[model samples]
Target chain A: MSSPERRTADGLERAQQLVRLKRYEQPDEGYFEGFLKEFQQRQRADLMQRSSRSLFCERLGTYLADFGGRRMLLAGGAACALALLFVRVAPEGQPVDAGFDAPRGEVTPVSAGPLFEGEIDLWEGMVVPAGDEEIDLPLFMVEPFDSRRAAGEPEIIEL
Target chain B: MADVKKRKPDEDRGLVERAKDGDTAAFDELVTKYSPKLYGLVYHMTSNHEDTNDLLQDIFAKAYRSLRRFRGRSAFYTWIYSISVNMTLNFLKKRNRHWKISLDDVDSAIEFDKEFIEQTSKTDPVRESNIHELQLRLNEAMMELSDDHRAVVTMFDIQGMPHNEIAKILKVSPGTVRSRLFYAHRQLQNHLEEFRR
Candidate 1:
């Protein structure tokens, strides 16, 4: 390991020397006053803009605790999970038939009156009645059928 | 010189104790005291005023946050510089490689260099060209060094921080600081050779 003194003749030393000398070089009194004012202005603006909390501390602490040097993998995993959830949770164009797979002893064929008239909740797998007034239908009117089989065969409704 | 040397150790210890106790005003005073020197270190490394300013804020904020963990392993100044250097290096890692150094007009070393040269020389063609050209070359050379190398060079060559202090700041041996400085200076010398006679 060489000392900076070894490179004293080097242009780097000269540049460093010039920079150091400039420190005490002292700007003209007017320039110094103006410089201090501007410097203070910048400092104040910077203080205002800076978050009260340190990003380096926040980011580094988060990375260490949550990501633990697997930031890419963790972030990728999170993104994939979000995407899958979106695909599953997003509303589909076609209304789902809740009566298709009613649990045993439950209504197998639940009619909401007219085709595609009402919305279905994929969450609870129930058909919601559309328009005004409640359409009276027995809870167990239709026999429950296998979803796979019901799906294979399209329902024929009478108006 | 004797007074500074005598005063430095006690002052460093007192500042560290106050900072550890969560006195923000004490820490701010420390920032005011050391910011100029650290600014030189950060500005030379980043070569961008906006980035340097941002990085400086982050560095101090980091030190303030991690004050509890500092543990008196090094002097307060060294510890803060360590935070400053590391934060700046990480920022450099994330910074766009294509972004050139945005030299500041307020404290440009090139202006000092030009003034120094005009005072010293009779007819030097190299330094005589538009100061703009020289500033560009010097800053470009500065921007080329790796972050670690640049930090050492910035602290040692540009800022005049001694190797022992740098070692303490970087949490390394003086030998390591010396080696980094040597290599960085060599690299910088090569880059700025055009400025030499």
Candidate 2:
């Protein structure tokens, strides 16, 4: 490798020196002042847009993208999943909410009168007390299915 | 010179430490100190001012965001410069080749520069070319070089950075830096032969 000083009179040196004119290419007057102000504005906007929590989460996400951190996260996730699977697979375990006193009798399906005629009986088979007027559930609001309207199968409703 | 050299990095280290501790003012100081230099680096590589300004902002923002991970293994100056050069190089790759060369106005002080007078005083083709024409031709010649070569030329020639510092910023060995400069200079000479009498 040759030093630039040792080749001052050569064409390479002249070309190198010519490029020195590039130093004069400064921005317009007051550009730096404007630049700094614009930068601060941008910084404040950035701060307003992204909270420290998001910044930390972004950094954490970046850190966890690396090999060691990814492996650690994967191990932790596997452990949590294993704990969940253990609890779920244990049939002898008590129901999750044992204290909530949900109704515990057989719920036989009930026959329904046509809706729209206002003869719908909602509490026919459910074991509510005879005068239990507190359960004021609305009847189904659809028109009765017509035998003449059974011409075509219903379109599959994509959930 | 040696004492000054030793003190600069220590000063930068103090600022960097403070900035890492969430001191926005410290980071602003760093930005104020390096923006002009990095602006030159990006502007010369791009031959466009708007792109340089945008890239400079992004470079500092990225540095501030990543400051916590900066481990002082390198000087803050070198680390920021590394980020600057790499970011500019990546940006150049994505920049459109057909984009217009929107140059910043040459500083008025160039008229009184001894080197500029000497350069323009010669009876060569360069002396016949006006400043605007010269700037265009020179930028065209530079843009002709490959991105890697152009980066080295911008650092070593235009910015007057030492080959070792450039090597540090570019993460290449000094020999590779020298090799790239050699070839880059050769290419520029061929393209800008008007500079030679």
Candidate 3:
């Protein structure tokens, strides 16, 4: 009995012998002549089998792989990112307009009187009126006037 | 010889460039150049004429479609050969083992092969009767191998590819290729022991 390594060597030698026999198996010479035609026919059939959308995508991908198309895609992406960045950062630095930026519904303008001269009673809240008129008003009406003054409105009025 | 070898690839590169530009004629020239060789590779692996024909067609079709992605990192020959091997292995995995082989006629020129002469001289009394049977048994023994082992044998022994070339094609190390060939030869030897007897 041969050692495993020796057996492997002998087997490889014999296998090489048999491999040579495989070369004997050959198609007719005519087969080679017709092979190109057959390949072309099959290629055409393959083309026909492909959907138009896939064909279009294949062509598009090929086009996009070129220098100009790649540059165009990069430029387009950069432009979109810059546009989005401007949109995000623009509103933060914009100046606030009192007339336009203020809330519109269910509110009116108010004004603040001289700060030290206004009454500051403990039981009654600080009373600051637009003018010297000490009109006796309900607490709810006074509350609205205070709220309008806090919101930086120019005058106090009933809605 | 070196000049001849160098010039061939340069010519192939030209054809490949034209084919990339959608020149069907340039591609047809490539098909003409490689089909016979590719046919031999697939046919020996499959042991079936019709299957080899169909597989060869599919391989070329795939190569043509994939030409745009071919970056010339490897020689065109090596690239196409890799494609042929991969597709054939995938095919063998899916194919039924019980399917019958459709071998083409052995060429008359084989009578002149040195190995054939040596084999016939050794088995002269039984050669005439045993040649076809022996060939069939050889193919059966090959089929009995694992797909990976069979690929190594087909590439190394039959196609005469180097270990490094086989490694590149199969994406394995050269050491792995050697081990696979060693094991495959041992298995084939066991399967065909009757011929030795």
Instruction: Say which candidate scores most in lDDT.
Output: 2
TM-score quality measure for candidate 2: 0.67
Q: How far in Å is the alpha carbon of A72 misplaced in model 1?
A: 30
TM-score of chain B in each prediction: 0.80, 0.86, 0.83
Ranking by lDDT: 2, 3, 1
Q: What is the lDDT of residue B80 in candidate 2?
A: 89
List, residue by residue over A2-84, the lDDT tens digit for candidate 3.
69777667666776676556755677669977888888887888789999999999878766665466688899999999979
How do the residues B1-197 of candidate 2 rate in per-residue lDDT, one tens digit apiece?
23223535545888888887778888888888888888988888887777788999999888887787777888888898899889998999898877655444334455666767776776466677777767777888888999899999988888777777788889999999999999988889888876576
Q: Who is ahead in DockQ, 1 or 3? A: 3
Off by over 4 Å in 1: A1-159, B1-7, B19-22, B102-127
Q: Specify the poorest-scoring 10-residue window by lDDT in model 2 chain B.
A: B1-10
Better of 1 and 3 by lDDT: 3
Candidate 2 global Cα RMSD: 9.5
The estimated TM-scores of all candidates read 0.54, 0.67, 0.67
* DockQ of every candidate structure: 0.08, 0.30, 0.25
Error of 3 at A158 (Å): 65
Lowest lDDT 10-residue stretch of candidate 1 chain B: B1-10
Tell the DockQ for candidate 1. 0.08
- lDDT tens string, model 2, A1-159? 376655544877788878887777677668887888888899889989997899889788656653366689789999999989977886785676655789888989977963223233433522233453544444354344544456676655569
Query: Cα RMSD to native, each candidate?
Result: 14.1, 9.5, 12.3
Write down the lDDT that model 3 would get.
0.76
